[model samples]
Target chain A: MNYCSDCGATVSLKIPENDERMRFVCDTCGMIHYQNPKIVAGVLSVRGEQVLLCRRAIAPRYGLWTLPAGFMENGETTDQAAAREAHEEANATLRDLRLYTVISVPHVSHVHVIYRCELVSDDFAPGVESLETRLFHEHEIPWDELAFHTVRKTLECFFHDRKQGVFPVHNLAFTIALPT
Target chain B: MNYCSDCGATVSLKIPENDERMRFVCDTCGMIHYQNPKIVAGVLSVRGEQVLLCRRAIAPRYGLWTLPAGFMENGETTDQAAAREAHEEANATLRDLRLYTVISVPHVSHVHVIYRCELVSDDFAPGVESLETRLFHEHEIPWDELAFHTVRKTLECFFHDRKQGVFPVHNLAFTIALPT
Candidate 1:
């Protein structure tokens, strides 16, 4: 950060007294600007043996398929965020949502949480951020076009555990590949 | 946030196109600064039948008993943050850590994650952030002097699950009490 948001003063990167890490400290306001990892909450909507996937219309992986997800906003729980993302991206209503996976991607400074939710109905369409939306059975999933590793991992676990007839919450992490 | 950290430009609080919530937006830099909930990662270190607790030396609950926990910093996973908090608050070494509780405090926009850990040794003392450290059995716990609800909830879950002989990861949420 070049300037402190609190005071509009120039900031310096220095270790504060009694602290081990270097942080952005403001010269005028004496404010410490600390940045931290964010959470991306979404849903893995299930209807019978099918799951919902949306085609991204935005950049960074446009045209690729992804589950409905987005950066969580303040004042909402992870479950609320996941449901909201589902509505916004795929126009899907959810019911009986359960936390399924929590994955930390350190490379991107994000923790992704996906819920296993029952689709309220078979009716769904693409929202503004999606080019298209559809339900896919395991055989019809476009594995090669999945938008993120978190999505792939959650789906893989979901299908794997379905065969076992028991679904346990997954607490997992994966290192994101650094930019070339 | 008043000014853009990237360009030192005054920012406006407005809803961007296709976004439902208002955010701090810098017109000059086209930067949208969004605030989201943070994860407070900690450990519930158990030994035999006792659990570790630390008395806070910091404000916001000075001298109240709590488990070692703090905000998850950038570039670190939840596991690392939990371990670091243990070291920084109680000078405790922990092992065999397993994700135990995930509680969403939406009113505060924070998620508290606690892991079930085994204390490496009982030779820990109070760190700078802690006034005193001690091990507490179920009956010996200072129930009336707990620092936060998440700590109380985690401890309750731990003790309850101990009796059941099966400790499944808890995904729970509680409405945060509004600040007075």
Candidate 2:
């Protein structure tokens, strides 16, 4: 944001005469640059009685377990992104994926969309970003070793919904505590 | 991302010859840098027959209409983000914001999580990031003036679901054409 896209001039943060907050405005083109948060989408692929999980091959929370998920790419739909992530992380194809949960982590400026996907086939293995991939029954979930809070929340909601058989049509909320 | 967070030294993305993408050795702190896509959450506030829409005060699409939404902050859940956005943009409190749509726009690297929020109060004015705010009935919606593809799709889904009196429980695929 140091340089202006409209003109090759340096930009400055200023409060507009009509506005109270300061915005980065280009003196040359009078353009105001506003940056918004990004969205992350993934799938919770499930076999009859088991859920698919991936072991991370990269850092941040490497060696930890997680569902197949990734950032949404341009021009692709959410379902498409979910399917793509499933293919990339586990080489799994999904049939019906229901909107499971939407988790927001404002501190990191991201929104996570998790889908409950029915596994179309048993064909799966670790992909580029995954070290290992496996299926875990409800009782066998690696709860303590799960990589992110959103993943944990999604699983919790899924199990709760499965039990209630009511499968709430409404969205739920939870908080994630980051390690200080 | 190949750098030491502690000592500011360069790191490598390569895994040791024998390691199966499991171990990432940092040249400095020897710490692995793990990366993951973030989550974003927002609300689709509906007031009776009309839905709340905001004109973005910032770019990528400045002055374009959109739902009140933003990225999820750390420690906050998706539902929290949705409520927060609704308050922030429309100054409206929501009750029973059912999960409406989860759109993954891959090309832009974002997963849009939209909730169908019930407007609790009519006390709303334009927020800081909004050029202007207004409510539009289904037929009066400025579809062509929407800021993002995901927003458009979510609204369309809302109407479709409203017609059937059946809110979608699953994620659906949609393609958004780039503006000509």
Candidate 3:
């Protein structure tokens, strides 16, 4: 941040008193601007034996297939955010929601929490942010065209667990490899 | 926030085009400043049949007892944040961390995530943020003296789960009553 949002004064990065990390401290207000990771809430909405996927119409992996998800908003639970994303991105309603995968992507400062839920009905359409929304069987999933690693990982876990007729919450951390 | 952190411009809250929520928009730079809920990571450190608690040396609940927790910092996983908080507040190291209670406190826009872990050693002391650190047996826990709702809920879930010998991850949301 170039300026303090509180005082409109220039800010400098420094370690505050009794703190070990460097933070943006305002010159005038002395306010510390702290930034934390964000939660991306989404859902793996299931029909009989298929899962819903939305083709993004927005930038940053545009046209790629992904589970309906987005940055969680304030004043909402993670599950609420996940359900809302399903409605907003794919015009889909979900039921029987259960916490599935919680993956920490520290390199991008994002915690992706995906819920495994049953689609309310087969009456979903593409929402504004999606070019198309469709249900795909496990063998038909666009694995190579998936938008993100978190989505891919969640699906991998879901299908593997489905065979055993048991689903367990998965907690994971992912790191992107730096260029050699 | 009164000013844009990006350009030092005055800001006004409004719903941007194609958006449902009101966000601070910079008058000069037109930067949208969106705010979201933060994650508070903590731990329930166990030794034998006791769990650790820290007395706060900080504001909001000075001297009140709680599980060691703090606002999660950037570039860290939730489990890492929980471990760091235990070390920072109680001078405690933990092992065998398992995801436990995840509670969303929407009134304050915070998600409190606590991990159940084993205390590494009995050599522990209060850290800078704690006035005292102590281990309490289930019967000796100061239920009414707990600092936060999330902590209480976590402990309640833990003890109840311990009896069944099955500790399933609990996902919950808490709401505080507004003064009548």
lDDT of 2 by residue, B54-172 (tens): 89987779988999988655446567767887777777778986677765554445556677878876788887778787888999999899987778888878888889998775465
Best by TM-score: 3
Clashing pairs in 3: none
Q: How well is each residue in B1-180 modelled by candidate 1, as lDDT tens digits?
A: 889998888999999987778999997998998899999999999988899999999999999999999999988888888999999999999998898998899988899988899998988999999999999999999999999999999999999999999898888888846869
> What is the C-alpha local distance difference test score of candidate 3?
0.93
Give candidate 2's error at residue A180 in angstroms.
Answer: 12
- How well does chain B match by TM-score in each candidate? 0.96, 0.84, 0.97
Model 1 CA deviation exceeding 4 Å by range: A176-180, B176-180
Of models 1 and 3, which has the larger lDDT? 3
Give the per-residue lDDT digits (tens) of candidate 3, residues B104-178. 888788988899999999989999989999999999999988999889999999999999999988989997776
Residue B51: error of model 3 in Å? Answer: 0.4
Clashing pairs in 1: none
Q: Model 2 chain A: which ten-residue window has the lowest total lDDT?
A: A167-176
Q: Where in model 2 is the C-alpha error above 4 Å?
A: A1-33, A166-170, A173-180, B1-96, B103-114, B120-166, B169-180
True contacts kept of each: 0.75, 0.35, 0.84
